[model samples]
Target: DLHNRFKRGARSYTGTCKDEETQMVYKKGQSWLRPALRSNRVEFCRCDNGYPRCHSTPVQSLTNDCFTGNGTLYRGIQSRTESGNSCLKWNSPRLILKTYTAWKKNAHDLGLGSHNFCRNPDNDRKPWCYVLKDNLETWEYCDVPKCSTCGLRQYKESQFRIKGGFFADITSHPWQAAITTLDRRSPGKTHFLCGGILIDSCWVLSAAHCFQERYKVHEIRVVLGSTYREKKEEDEQVFEVEKYIIHEKFVSETFDNDIALLHLKPKADSLQCAQETKSVRTVCLPDAGLQLADWTECELSGYGKHEENSPFYSERLKEGHVRLYPSSRCTSRHLFNKTVTENMLCAGDTRSGGKEGNLHDACQGDSGGPLVCMKDNRMHLIGIISWGIGCGEKDVPGVYTKVINYLKWIEDKRRL
Candidate 1:
């Protein structure tokens, strides 16, 4: 029987009842069994089949009867029967009443431990604590840390990060250069004109109506540093345009003062190998007060007509992304009541418009060019082209002339 009570040896007993002839067992509460028999060890006792009675006392009948005077209830029933049956097989009073009814129903549902604590209060769960509240809308649950999604602000609030491509590496100037012209002539053959950065070794800027009424500064030829105008004789340094200024209030059918500059007479032995040329150079202009807001982002670049009246040329240098509108949406309530002076700055997108293969505005020889705008990583300039209506249609936005309102007439005509 359980190894005959583990090889039973101790047995002794004297009696107050069941004396199966001196085997002297005894039952009926032997004086309430002297409080569980103070012992020479082993005790329990209840068995008339109600089961407990183990037995083996008499270390002098263990202080006898109700343990004489009760020395702390005779050492708490002889230290609960010398701790033997390991707390009587888990001292079960029915597993302590089912572990106190599961900790009193999880301390009244504040749920316990691993966060699912109780689970029902309209359960989409996620709240666990700390949430103060104020504006909160993105995906909703916000107590405040923000950005749960909706971003893209920057109209020069400048945070950048962007990185997707093809608007000519997001608007040129890692040294800047350009030539482009697949050759779809109109008057004398070689046409392509809008792009002109390269602000030094003889200046360039560009866009006084891309030299209105067609060609002049030596019938236009300049392709310095290169961006592929049929490879401009594999560019070592090609130059020509020698002189051009144009802003004497350049008007041409309300194109409102488009700027221009050019210059370049000598200096290109590739300007002493222009630092071993690759992206070409020069671009810094935007400083005096700086303004340029509305939707900001600028950058244009061109050789014009990538599609419209397509004779198929534009081999590369194309770029074109714009944004800056909002001068009361480019002045026209009768040209802003006849004064007409918002000094221009609009950009396109009259509801997803901009046609001709969508380089998106700055066409028919992209007049006077250079809008640019990088910031901190340099490349500045900031708007000059002017005039639009076709090349990105609808309410036709694409004007430009506000280079910070002509930075003191471009530093008093470039003296600085």
Candidate 2:
């Protein structure tokens, strides 16, 4: 094997360090030489006649931010802790003998033979390794992301996605729900009305304003695990709304208390409405005490129209970054004197909107979508898309139902 074929050892070159002014003569030619620089880093190398050299191609595993099945199959080369400490070599005598013991038990399966790559040999919360922090060998967790964790996603970027916002895959915002209504004009067809968030297995959160038409329960359908606005993927889960409850205090005239919940009908022969998958999972609800600083950057996603004038909703999902606005700026005066109640918060693209004037904000079809913020490396649902003066208008932020204010109400209502 290459490991045994390459003998890693210290070099013993007899060549003397040269100065820049010194002329070095070789069989091919002679030229002025520079002094050799020394590095304090320890590296593996093969020696040829007392000269250190790399003779083999480096074998690297595909990088992944998250893992599956206890991370035994994780082959990532992440060699640092969350706090930026270098991982101790798994084969280091000090680590194997003093700090770590699982290497000997599960080396082959865990890929912990000689490399210092981060792995979860013992199945802890995540892959971790021993580090020499402050001269003491202590264990610290690595920075691997959880694949199935709510509010976390594998975001992939590419060109030609969206104009105002980046094109996003559903896996990045797995909790996104497409609330549709049976089209009265076309039989067996549905139309996208508003966006929703999958808060739990059997419940979805949306805006009370979306249901103001008072459609029949059988006419509403909630589609999850989808990335396209109209197309459905093989993994998509379609559910009929069993029942819906709008806030009793919701006033459609001013869009106050604009929050609603829909109970998903269970799948046939099963009590669950959705099965957790990589592209389908529930988002974590923020606690009643959760509070983020003003201007904290958060994310919003939907298949909403690209802009106010766009007659069509986005063919694919799109995500936009926004900052939580200060309460003073999120007041009634800012939103054309519309009632900006205490239960409402505001967020929008705070950029000055240069010549392009392309600011990232929610659009026409994004109502009831999620406004999630990253906390403790996990995503927490913070707001629900309520209303906006216009899509991505300069200095005009989009208003949302402050989710934290309705946590208890949701808990009490979902139980029914």
Who wins the lDDT comparison?
A: 2
Kindly list the per-residue Cα lDDT of model 2 for residues 212-278, writing each as its tens digit.
9999999999999898978879989999989999999999888888999999999888877877787
Alpha carbon lDDT of residue 287, candidate 2?
Answer: 76
Residue pairs in clash, model 1: 45-53, 45-54, 46-53, 111-117, 175-280, 182-313, 206-368, 207-368, 210-368, 354-392
TM-score of 1: 0.23
Clash counts for the predictions, in order: 10, 0
Q: For candidate 1, write residues 42-107 as lDDT tens digits.
A: 333443422224455554454432221112222112212211211111122333332222234442
**Mind sharing the TM-score for model 2?**
0.65
**What is the C-alpha RMSD, rounded to one decimal, of candidate 1?**
33.8
**Cα-based lDDT for every prediction:** 0.46, 0.77
